[model samples]
Target: MSEFKRAITAEDITRLQVYSDPQFTPDGDAYTYVSTAINDKNEYESHLFYKKLNGSDATPWTFGNVKNSNAQFSPDGKKVVFQSTRSGLPQLWVLNTDGGEAKQLTFFKNGAVSPAWSKDGKYIIFNASLDHDDDVESQKEQSKEERQKQNEEKKKQPLVINRLKYKSDAKGFHDNKRNQLILFDVENEKFTQLTSADTDHGYQDISPDGNFVLFTANLNDDADYELINDLFTLNLKTKDITKLTDGKGGYHSASFSPSGDKIACLGHEFAYKGATLSELYVFDIATGERTCLSEKWDMQLGDLMIGDTRLGQSTTGPVWSKEEDRLFFIATDFGATGLYQVTLNSDLEVLYKDDNHVFGFSYDPHSDSFILGISTPTNPCNFYQLRKTSELVRLTNANAKYLEEVHVEEPETLTITADDDQEIQGWLLRPYGFEEGKKYPFVLEIHGGPHAMYGQTFFHELQLLAAKGYVVLYTNPRGSHGYGQSFVDACRSDYGGGDYTDLMSAVDYVLENYSFIDENRLGVTGGSYGGFMTNWIISHTNRFKAAVTQRSISNWLSFYGVSDIGFFFTKWEHGLNLLDDPAKLWDFSPLKYAENVETPLLILHGEQDFRCPVEQGEQLFITLKHMRKQVEFVRFPGSNHELSRSGKPEMRIERLNHICRWFEEYL
Candidate 1:
């Protein structure tokens, strides 16, 4: 080992770099990706970077403080198109590989994103939100004065709430606009509106021949109340549309097979409602026959599991192989996310498996290799190359230097059998410079989603706690993914029942096996579902000395009506609507038993959060204060539910500092 390094601190999180959206070139000789880092202004800036396949050093392709991402090479590999905010709004910019400045492609009013190149490379298609009644040209023709006048008149008008779904978490109110496909003719510089539907169209992929485009949309009359994502293909020549998937389940992330006769996507048929594991499905374009590729795998496809440090990267391309007989994708199994492959012949295999998280990857059929964006407990994020021989090559050392100067304790894995015979997966991190036979303070960190798993990913908060001479323990209880569908659905309606016992069982197991943990000085903290659990734990037990609940839900009754997805999520998870049984919702609520809380509790919440509204925290805080219990509520001014992961940099650091201060005071 090198010389003893300093303990990791909250400020170090701002220095961490996040890498994502790796896209391989057509010839498989080079690849482009986005590297995001916090700048001096405390803002995250993403830039484009690339490296050659022949062991060449990575070079920056784009430079700036603005964010640039979703880069993909043209079919001819002569030009690269990406979305960037360099022009004040996210717009398409194409850069020639051999040289000069990148040219702006679109000036759409709502901006453009997710650029997809056509097979012939003559057209670039992208998605942009547009007003339902106005065309792009008409909107552009309006003067600034006229637009300001219309906005003022609209503000004076009464707010009409017509749609069942009106408000979103990050987005305040749902505008009467839709995301439609826009085709940009590269040679002529012409923009054409493809679809004029009221429903939002989610872009999938274009056909190999470039004659058709596949997309997902819920175009039903009752789309607001129903969860139905149907696949449709729009013909380029005839301008005709064809529906591919039946209204059976929610399907998305569709990709066209190389031969254009089949489409594979990830979706669930509401088998277990919101907790249903996403399975891979192949739909035959010629016969309309659909096959479930991962019916027997018993694993959740894609990366729904959450980590504290970084936001989740999208799982890309069910990337069909050259022959189009097999497909490659990512799956979360046990406690790690790995690349997996499944064939039409029912053959399934794990291509890459390790105790690390594979956020995204791009496969090149010509080279039979993959460019992966992966992370581990110690590393923030980096790019790597994986060959058929299972050999791994590091492509970027984005955080290697800073990491070498800091100490990140490795967590030991554990599998504890719960009281009801379910095995709970967990990990325990020892304090930095841990001494043998010395007892240390312990903190139980819970994860959100209750449906989200806590696994082999880099978590900054946990590391900071461990660096502060505290043993950090985290686990995936009954409602977590990575374990099978049945285990994930176990805690659906039993919020604090078996799942609570499962978490308690983990703590008990760790205390029994690790004698260095000071059980009496234990602390508990989590956000969202984890926050809900933290609240639930303190109300039910006095074992913890201090607790921090962030962006958490204290009352299910209020969550059913106030949350962004409350209307549907409540019914899906609890099997009860607000009108069905209010008493039952209250029974599972954490606030119902808040009067029993005896631990020193700290509540952290984002003021503008809409998922678990700030009101959830306010209600809990007021209840505790009224009861004369030890409590403190800290509110972040302009953050949403994702405050912990993607909030403003300065605010994120302050949130971390508050967490540490609260624990230091009582633990």
Candidate 2:
């Protein structure tokens, strides 16, 4: 094995590190971020960590073996306000900036999130699901009444509900109706409602002077709920609300400048090649001159957090520096994320250049250093402080202890030409302890969304496969983002045709170039669209010995009415309009070719998934079993489509173990 000792296990899923909501303290000398520390019991306790920009170590500010996160510093920098589920429901807690016993601020039942400090730090502003109720008993009563009504009406179709909140992935469909602004008094420990309205007013950002709150809402009770997300300013003292931007498209992510005279935000008002992209807009609240920064300053404005974001735009994440003169935000050209800086005067600059991931950034003006969070394909996430030098010094080594025993493999990117002569990008992680000439079995890994790009970052499951002596290959196919708009749009009408060719070409490239990879013993797997494609591949050719599809859409016709988002995404993605007849949806369904399948298949799904829904997997498994194909189905309880990403800890570990067990059993 290339003269090095061949290790039995190159890597194991021992540790996972992540940093959330990194921000600078008011003085700009220290930084704080929400860190989820995991332990052997397979439980997680999120805590806040603070380190001086130039200080040697980050100090933990929470204790008592509880869940804590989302820390925001007070204006004076003496104390930090954070959120914790330690109380069972997410509530606000305040602690000294230097570290002290935390005191609970809000005793809420419905749950509170997105805590924002007023400029004066005397008041805390946040959105709470005050009146939105989904009580089990209430739901039962409503459901029973609805069923009776439906029976009486004798509707065209039977009325049924798969779940209380169906179609939930990483984030559930939040029923925060009339999600109003709640004000908490720090001194008196009393709570007050700042804005009490029937309409939902979300995304609250306090002005620099703490006099106003900037937010977006459908104040007019508009019919097209998807239309404009107009900006509004609420006078916290007088309780007066004023509308700001009148432009079309969603206008959100508003933040006030240090001077309090101006505000910068992301605005979706332009269309590129029939697709919408956002522009950064800085509204001069005093003069009422709303400037479109993308048009005037060449700033990149991409749509972010869209329902189908991985397949669309990710133009979000904007926050102003302490000086308020420069605005920092994330920009995506093709599929990779880059951090950019835009001067309020209309000049844009690239701050950091790296493909894929950029996060955990804290700009402390007092220390003149940036505590940045970064990650690459081979490297697990680590916090770094960047000062005068370009190189970063590491802070927390979360995976050091576990990684000592594992010989983790790093990924390498490559370009493979498809049959259509289109150059498609791909990455391969050679089996850990790889040899020069000895061939090893390989697994073709496909990312979900079919639009999400598998960029530079270490994936636990992907690495686990590599550690088990199987070469792992993943690629960003034609419909994937990160390349550009056109590349992502390429797979729209031609779902199984050109996209299939790209995957086959990637495999061909692997067989031709990698002498250590076995083309004879090959396998394929993916989730979501990747899962759908897996079904497609095995039906066309029995090249893979085994295949596993997770939360997949095996049959489109069954997917049309069952999934919560199926109706909207169906028409948007494959042009399967609900109003018109669409035979094309069924034509692309993988179950259509189930008769030709020969490779053994394993189907994994979350029991609670309403996105692709659990039935899609069941349909595929039933049809395959009926055909007498070697098939098995594994279902995760209380899990959803995003179980592979943000599910419960025990369930997540079980998922990893099962995936390893399946691949180990087959390859």
Per-prediction TM-score, please? 0.97, 0.86
Q: Write the per-residue lDDT of candidate 2 for residues 543-575, one digit (tens) a residue.
A: 888788888998888777778766556766777
Off by over 4 Å in 2: 1-14, 132-167, 170-178, 198-200, 220-228, 245-248, 267-278, 287-289, 295-316, 333-336, 344-346, 388-391
Top of the candidates by TM-score: 1
Name the lDDT of candidate 2: 0.70
Cα misplacement distance, residue 634 of candidate 1 (Å) = 0.6
Displacement of the residue 284 alpha carbon in candidate 1, Å: 1.3
Please state every model's RMSD to the true fold in angstroms.
Answer: 2.0, 6.1
Clashes of each: 0, 9
lDDT of 1 at 619: 97
The per-residue C-alpha lDDT of model 1 at residue 267 equals 88
